[model samples]
Target: MTMPAFALDYLPLGAPDFSKIKETDYLPAFEKAIKQNREEVNKIVANKAKPTFENTVLAYEKSGVELDRVSNVFFALVSAHKTPVIAETEKKVMPMLTELQNEISFNKELFKKVKYVYDHQLKKLKGEDKRLTEELYKSFVRSGALLSDEKMERMKQINLRIADLQQEWGTLLPNATNNSVIWVNSKEELAGLSEADIAQCKKDAESRGGYTPYAIVIVNTTQQAILSSLDNRNLRRRVYEASRHRADGTRQFNTFPLVVEIAKLRAEMGELMGYNNYASYSLEKTMAKNSDNVYNFLKQLIAEYTPKAQAETKAIEDYAKKQMGTDFKLQPYDRFYYSAKMKQEMLNISDDEVKPYFNIDSVIVNGVFYAAHRVYGLNFVQRTDIPTYHPDMKVYEVHDKDGKLLALFYSDPYRRPTKRGGAWMSAFAKQSGLRQQLPIIYNVTNYAKAPEGQPTLITWDEVTTLFHEFGHALHGMLSNCKYNTLSGTAVARDFVEMPSQFNETFASIPEIFDHYAKHAVTGEPMPADLKEKMLKSISFQQAYALGENLAATCLDLAWHHLSSKEIPTANEAANFEVEALKKIGLYDEQVPPRYSTSYFNHVWGGGYAAGYYSYLWTDVLACNVAEAFQKFGVLKPETGNAFRQKVLSRGNTKDQMEMFTDFTGMKTPDSSGFLKYRGL
Candidate 1:
């Protein structure tokens, strides 16, 4: 029998041909690509000529092109339009990829050549070439290139197992989320929900293959957005429980075992690599430098924010008691609901009132793209000719200020049963000067779909999310790098988020806000007083919001801080999480961690193991960067070009902090700016 031909061979300007690709083609394609990549590596190893920078480091960088093409499309599909077949393909392909990685990382000959280039060729290489050589050498060392054979073999096993666990958790969690939807038997149970919300709930029930009156679909987070508006305490509790327990031991879809195994493997790997714990190993590559720095940073945040969060909780509790009488006690589900009411009471504003002004289309066109044009002088034209993975996805051709084509931007804007939860940006083809490649970047979001014939109106949070994810898109699309390895978003986890968070601040800019924030029905701009209240209301929940993030960050560190022997069993994970939160003094029954251990995908399934602190870490960097923009004027082209040249286009070619200092002309990043921005 012959394997089916795949469309991976030839891409139109490096853009994937998603239309011709089939699920069965994936495994064979990966097998072929891996073979080619191995042969490429072998050439470097076998060459009799003494290894030069071109023959070794540069050659290694250029190898795996075929593998990257297939893997990029395959993984992007698994993320954006998942099926059981894709999951199975992922399981098989991930281990193969892991084996390839281990082979290269552990290969003595390859490491020898790379080390030779690093040691003797410093004067010949310039700029990115020098940085790439240094980064590659460090990568080899960090990946156990210097380890003994026995330890290297153990490290390979750890890598393969970690890959398998990531695949399992990724597959299980989304299915668990779908199964955890709260089914309602009647309409009254959904009281306080708008007509659109009710209709969406009905549609959700229909999609679940039920004749039920309503269904409240669960997102990947512990807190449900719908909880803020739900008046029925019993129903709110049900929804909250569903979210909190989606991956907990309450169901067959439990990820507790995977979490434990993953942590244990990482701890052991860290020790084998000469670190105390996984956090130490992971932090060595990040801007934080070490675990102590991360701990101190998080500890300071907990101390400063805990009191403010407690005070805010008391204020909300007082207001809730006034409404429900002396017996009223606040639960986790009641926070969003009463806080929203409190916002209304204090500022005469609520999410529902502000949502009408945030039409999704306008937000993308005028708000997101408008800001892009202001900052980067990029233009977008819809590209219907290019085929997308899903019909909901929109393709646009991006052009630079001088009318040269820059990149392709894909946007998948609505939620479906097949798509995963959360919003993120990914690259199908990362920009590289060596390959003469232009980026094909896409942003995936999980906003609730508007009903047929109804416009998709979004909340302000969603509006900021649009700007945020596009911020990531810009990072990828605008990349001008010599090597794919040093391309956009390939920086340290702690530093990678700075660009996106900086972009998020643009959503509230008065000029940019005016361009997009208009009534969906009336096309009228938001009233002056209402707009002010809406913007002010954004900071109202800052304490609770930041505290939850800090707690989750602390929880991530706690899990990763363990030694191999100290890893908890699956049964002990819950108690472990409780104790972890208590240790950090962030344990609040009314305000749970944003993500519990079992469902903390960032550490277990995603790439953020021991790195979830990147959010808070980069939040400070983002606030400081935003402050720099204020000095030169936020929308000035000179300021924009300087940022683009210094930070955006440099990729990982320079030190992360040096890049910030380049733009800010500062000796160090300031946490005071972050505090002022957060109103702390």
Candidate 2:
């Protein structure tokens, strides 16, 4: 009965001893943790005493401590740094975990007690107590606790299958992306790329066994970043096609089959839960409340933005024609390259001109952390004594305004072959007053690394990404919730993105931008005119940005809005995506979805299934909040503290919209902020 290294609490809390964790330890840790969790639940269920708030709801909230700890570390490693052993471990452990969840949810005695507490003590309980009791009861119902024995059994099966399918899709994507790299044998094909970029390509080639002189590694998105820089049209087309077709059946790690299976299974799961489709079931607890609202929101934006997007495309196309002669027809591969050219010509700015001021280290320390320090009176000190899972990671101890240690922050900013694409924030431990735990948060990004001894310069997009992810980290770090279930980023899907997106507003603020955007080698600030041009160019591609996002959101809705009978087959998935986009009037070959269906990890593998619209939904709230900040002085500590108290720290303890209203002094969020923020 010895506790595994991962299951045991670190002496200081928040910091896991990564050195003691092994590839072999995960399975055993999961097994022991699951057993321990089951025993704890049994203890509550077997209690002969009358069910009360303390004996039932609170007990359930705290029951799975060991399991949560083990699962957190295991899953964090699996996503951020997966190996064959971890992948195999996930395959075994996911089903076991799902089965354990079913057992708890369907425990008749446990549900009866939870129901008793919720029903009888409902009005007597107040604040988080009332909220937790209600939430726990609803959670049990959502897990099919209210179903008949027969239906519950079927529900359990569907849950297991869905989990398996999601895991399969998740496992396939990174390999698919890695395998989808476009190799170029000649240096001539890599023209227009910087020396640093070419060096990184060679490094990537060497890392992948050196079959080619250079390799353009495909990212998780439909559009490859290199498309904006590569001079060779054929090479650009090759990279773009590889990105779009990644994880399709044409690739070694095809996820098309898994996508079809997962979507259909999810629809079936929703039907069992008495919902029309998965989107209904999933959006029940989100701020959007239902699929209709989400659709309406997206459609309104689509109608407004489509004309603008087309106009933007026409402008770029005209510019391309002027440069390459009227015979040039702009394709998807040509979008980014010509858009960059048009942007430079129109706005007198380019990513290269701006990137020198955005050294990754400076952006993090001077830009992201500096913004936090100014607004929230927080400070970050590097903790080199701590161990990390990867050498690229740096750990910092965060201190609050009062000089008390608040949280531990971990930054993983470089891309590697094993690491997944995109950026995210997660926690090793979440803050909770009840549990007396401080947050241990990490932000992971896929910024391409510079060669050793070279300062890593990032584009403005990556710079904003650092701030955005840290916004989620700040949510965790600033949490003042009493219950573990209601802490940190545990709010509604739609509401959770608000804090992160709101954090992005600071990235462009003059005070913070000037602090972070320093010359990498010269250690000097950007010239004033150049800064103005960079700032003005923010809205230069608003059409394409909004168009891609709208397409992806619409695609998410299309898949989840379907009933089981309407779900597409594996082979039909690609065509289904195109048709869905066309139906929504977003089927631009030049402006594809931010993520295509086969490799849409957020929907198929990640927890965002039927919920990717949260980005757009929450942007409404973020923009309104940003407007409020702008009115009250963006860098004012008073404004920061108000937001920290009213929004970030509150977590899921209150209604999300109510929390927003409380901070912004508005009855409803103003959607006008969306257009204003986008500069449309």
Collision pairs in model 2: none
lDDT of candidate 2 over 1-680, digit per residue (tens): 12333464453655777876678887988899999999999999999999999999999987887888888878888889998898899999999999999899899999999999988999999999999998999999999999989989999999899888888777788889888888899888899898888998999899998898888888767887778898999999888888888788564677888888888888988999999999999999888889788888888898899888888889889989998998989999999999998888888899989899999999999999999999999999999988888999999999998999999999998888768889999998888788778888999999888988989998888888889999999999999999989999999998899999999999999899899888999999999999999999988878888888889988999999999999988889999999999998989987899999988888888889888998988888899999899888899999999999999999899998899989899988889658768888
Candidates in order, TM-scores: namely 0.98, 0.98
The TM-score that candidate 1 achieves is: 0.98
Candidate 1 ranges beyond 4 A from true positions? 1-11
Alpha-carbon lDDT of model 2 = 0.88
Q: Residue pairs in steric clash, candidate 1?
A: none
Show where candidate 2 strays beyond 4 Å.
Answer: 1-11
lDDT of each: 0.88, 0.88
Deviation in angstroms for 284 in model 2? 1.5
